[model samples]
Target: MRPPVRLALAAAAASALQIPLQPPNGANVQPVLVESDALADRVGAGNLQKRAEALYEIAELSVDEYGHPTRVIGSRGHLGTINYIKSTLDGLGGYYNLSDQIFSAVSGSVYQAKLVIGDVVPSFTTMGLTPATENKEPVHGDLVLVGDLGCKSSDYPDTAMGSILLIRRGECSFGQKSELAGQAGAVAAVVVNSEQDEIHGTLGAPSPNHVATFGLSGATGGGFIEKLESGEVLDAIAYMDADVDIIETMNIVAQTTHGDPDNCVMLGGHSDSVTEGPGINDDGSGSLSVLEVAVQLSHYKVNNCVRFGWWSGEEEGLLGSNYYVASLSEEENAKLRLFMDYDMMASPNFAYQVYDATDAANPVGSEKLRDLYTAWYEDHGLNYSLIPFDGRSDYDGFIRHGIPAGGIATGAEGVKTEAEEDMFGGRAGEWYDPCYHQLCDDLHNVNLTAWEVNTKASTFALSPFALSTTRSTANAGWV
Candidate 1:
C-alpha cells in the first residue's frame, strides 16, 4: 500500500468525481448494494452525467462488438466475433490476461434455399441456416402447414419424407426443431418468423436427412398469401444441410487468485452468438461491462480467489460452463462462494430485470439479488422487475453443481409483456430486442438505461460478495 499522500492522490484521480474512494466512516466501507446515503450523496448530478456518457459509449461498443460475426464453433457467417471479444479484453490492458476454454455444441449441419415468384428473386435474409453442401436434390411439392413442431409436440403429420412443411419457430430448442423435422415425413421445412417484426424470415435446425430449409419475410409471406388468393403460384424451395461435424469452440478465462483460496467467486458472460447476428446486446454488453470491471479490479490485491470466465457455445446451449463445472473436483468446488453471470446487459430498450429466486420463502445466491436490485432501482428511481431463474443463463452450470449461483441479464430471445411495455415505454407488443440475433443487432442498437441498470446492478451487488466469498466457502465445509 502507498503512503497517505500517495493514496490520497491516487484516490482522487481514480475515483469517479462523483464517488469518493473511502466510505464517510473511513476504513469501514459500505457496499454499494446497500444504497447508503453516503453513496447517494457522492453520486451527485455532475458525476452521474459523466457516468451516463461513459455508459452510452460502452453500450454502443458492446452492441457494435456483439454482431460482428463472432461465432464460436465456426458456422456460416460467424466471422471473428470471438476474436474481437478476446482482443477487446486484451486491449482493455490488464493482468486479468485472457485464457481460452474450448467446447462443442454438437449439432448437425443445415442447408437452406427459397423459391418465391419466379422471374422474381424474392427478398430474403439468409440467416444461420447453411444449405447442405453434401446432400442437395431438387424436389417439388405442395406446401404443408405444420404448427409448433417442438420435440414433444408430436402433432405435425410427418413432413420429412418429400412434402414441404411450413413450421413456425417457437417453444423448443433449435436442435429439437431439427429432430422434429427429421421425424416428420417432410423433405424440407419452411420455418417462417413467428412475429411480424422478426428480422430473419426462417429458422433452420441442424439435422441428418434434413433437406432444404427456407425463409420468406413477413411481407413476402403476406404477398404470397395475396398471390394464393389471386390463384397464382406461391412455389418456394428449402433445404436443411446436415453434413457438418460437431465443432469445438474456445472460451477465454483469466484468474485472480486472492481472498481465501477455499472460497471462490466467479464472474463470466458468453462470448458467442447466432449465425447472422453480432450478439453484442445478446451478450456483448455484458461481456464488455464485466470485462471492464474485471480489468479495473485486477490491479487490486483482493480477498477470496476470483475467476473471470468468458463462455463459448452458449448460443446453442449452456455447454461450456456446464463442462467447466463438471470438470472441477468435488473438493475444489466446495469453496465456491457464488457465481454471478452477466448476460445481455445492454438491451437498447430493456426494462431493469432481476432473477426472482430465493424469495422470502427461500434465499439463494450470496443473498438473493432481489434486495440489491430493488434498492438500486429505488435509489435511481427507475422501473424494475424480478423474474424467476429458469436456468436460462450460464449460471446453469453452478446450479447443476448445487452451488448457489445468481446472474444478471438485460434482455434476450423473448418478447416483453404488456405490463413491461407500460413500464418501459416502447412499442406495445414487441420483444425487448428485435435485433437480438440478426446482423442488425449492431452497436447502434443499445438502450442507455438498460445498460446502466445491468452494469450498476451487477457491480453494486457482485463486488462486495466477491470480496467476501471466503465466508461462503467456510460455511460450505459444515454443510
Candidate 2:
C-alpha cells in the first residue's frame, strides 16, 4: 500500500475561505439546480490565480537538490501538489466522496546525451525508454548514413550493420525507426530532427526490440550529412546515461455525494508537470480551473453526480487517467455519462479551440459534447475553432473505452496560424505556448484573460450536466 499524504492547514484554510459552502440538500429531497451563468459567475479568476501561485510555490519547494522545478510523477514537487489538492478537498468537509486512486508508472530520466563525430561533440536528447550505457561509457561505432528516414527495413544499408545508423525524424514514430535499426543489426540509432531545433520527444513506449536511440538537432545532423556527402568516413560515439524505474503515484477523484450516482458527469485536468518546469500554464491553469469550480460548486446542489479528477503522470503520457479507466468495472464504466477534459487552458498565444469530436476519432456522444462547447462560445460572443480529438491528453483513455469525451485547449507547441491570430488576437508565427515543456513554463506563463474565459466556459458546459443528463444526449451513440 502507498503511504498516505498529510493535509496542509494552509490549503484547508484557503479552501474554506475562498468559497462559502452551502447547507447540504438531503439526498432524499429533489436536488436544486443552478444555471450555467450563475455557476460560472461564482468561479473567480483571482481565486484561480491564487491557486496557481500557490502551486508554483509548492513546485519550487519540492524540487530536487539540482534545482529543477519539476512536478513529474514520483517527484517531491508532485507529492506536494497531491497533498495540496487532497487537503483542499478535505477542507470541503464531507461534501465529496474523495478517493486517492493509486497506481504504478515507469519514471525515466536522462542525465546526459552527447553525439561525438571525430573532433565535434554536439548536444542531443535521449529518447524515452532508451537503455542506459554500461557504466556511463560511450558506445563507439562507424557512422553509416541510411538513405531515406530509415522507417522502412529496406532503407537500412549493409554498411549499417555493426555501425550506428543515422536516420532523420519523420514518416514514422521513433520506436519504429529504432526497431528497424535494431533489426538491421545497427549498434545504435540517431534520429536527426527534421526541424531546426533539437528533438525532445519519446519513443511512445518501451519495446524490447529497440536499441539505444538519441534525438539530434538539425544543425548537428546537417554537418554530419555534409561530411558523408563529401565521402569522408565519420567515426561516431553516441553517449547516454539514463535510468527508468517503476514509481507509485496517485490520482484525486472527487465526486459530490448529493446526486444520483448512476448518472455521473466527469471533468478533469492533469496535475503534474514535465521535469523541466513548474508547468503553471501547461496544466496548472486547467487543473486549478477545475479545482476552483469544484470548490465553488460546493455552494450549490446537483441532480446528477459530478466528479472532478486531478490526474497525475499526464506529462509522462496520460498514465494516471489510463490506469483509472482500465481499472474500472463494467458497471462503474456505465455510470460515466460524459467526460470533459481541460488541458493547457491559458496558453500565451491562445485560441478558443474546442475538441472536434464530430470528425475522425469521434466517440459516441462526443459530437454532442462538442456542440455544447460550440454553442456556449457562440452564446458568449466568443470566437472558437475546432481541435481534433487527437488522443493527446488525459481524455484519450476515456475515449478509447467508447465513452463520450470532449474538452478545450488554448493551444500548445503548435504554431499559431494567421487565421488563428486574427481570430484570437495573438502573434501568428510564434507557438501557442512558447514556454511549453521548458524551464520557462513558470507562474507568469499564463494569460489571465484566457485562463478566466476558459474556466468560465468549462463551468458553463458542466453546470447543465450537473443538474441533469437530460441536456446531453451522450448515451444515444454509446456502444
Instruction: Write the residue-wise lDDT of candidate 1 on 7-111 in tens digits.
Output: 122222223222221112212222332222322233232322343333333223323323344333453222243444444455444534457665555433333
| Candidate 2 RMSD computed on C-alpha atoms after optimal superposition onto the true structure | 4.7
For model 2 the local lDDT of residue 56 reads 80
Q: Which stretches of candidate 1 lie over 4 Å from their true place?
A: 1-99, 104-112, 115-134, 146-160, 168-172, 191-236, 239-245, 359-363, 416-418, 469-479
Candidate No. with top lDDT? 2
Candidate 2 has its poorest 10 consecutive residues by lDDT at 1-10
lDDT of 1 at 389: 80
Each prediction's whole-model lDDT (CA)? 0.55, 0.79
TM-score of the candidate numbered 2? 0.86
> Model 2, which residues run further than 4 Å from truth?
1-32, 117-124, 147-149, 183-187, 194-198, 217-233, 359-361, 471-479
Estimate the overall C-alpha local distance difference test score of candidate 2.
0.79
Candidate 2 per-residue C-alpha lDDT over 1-479 given as tens digits, one digit per residue, 9 for 90 to 100: 22322223324324323232222332232334767888788776777777887888777754543267767666666777777787677777677889988787766666667778778777776776576654567888899988888878899998887788788888888889988888898778888988766676666566666777887878788888778878999898877776665677889999998788988889999988876678899788998888888877877789889999999878777888998899899899888878999999999999999989873456567887788889988998999999878788999999888678899989987778899888899999888998988889988899999899989988888887777656335443422
On the 0 to 100 scale, the lDDT of residue 438 in model 2 is 80
Question: Each model's TM-score?
Answer: 0.70, 0.86
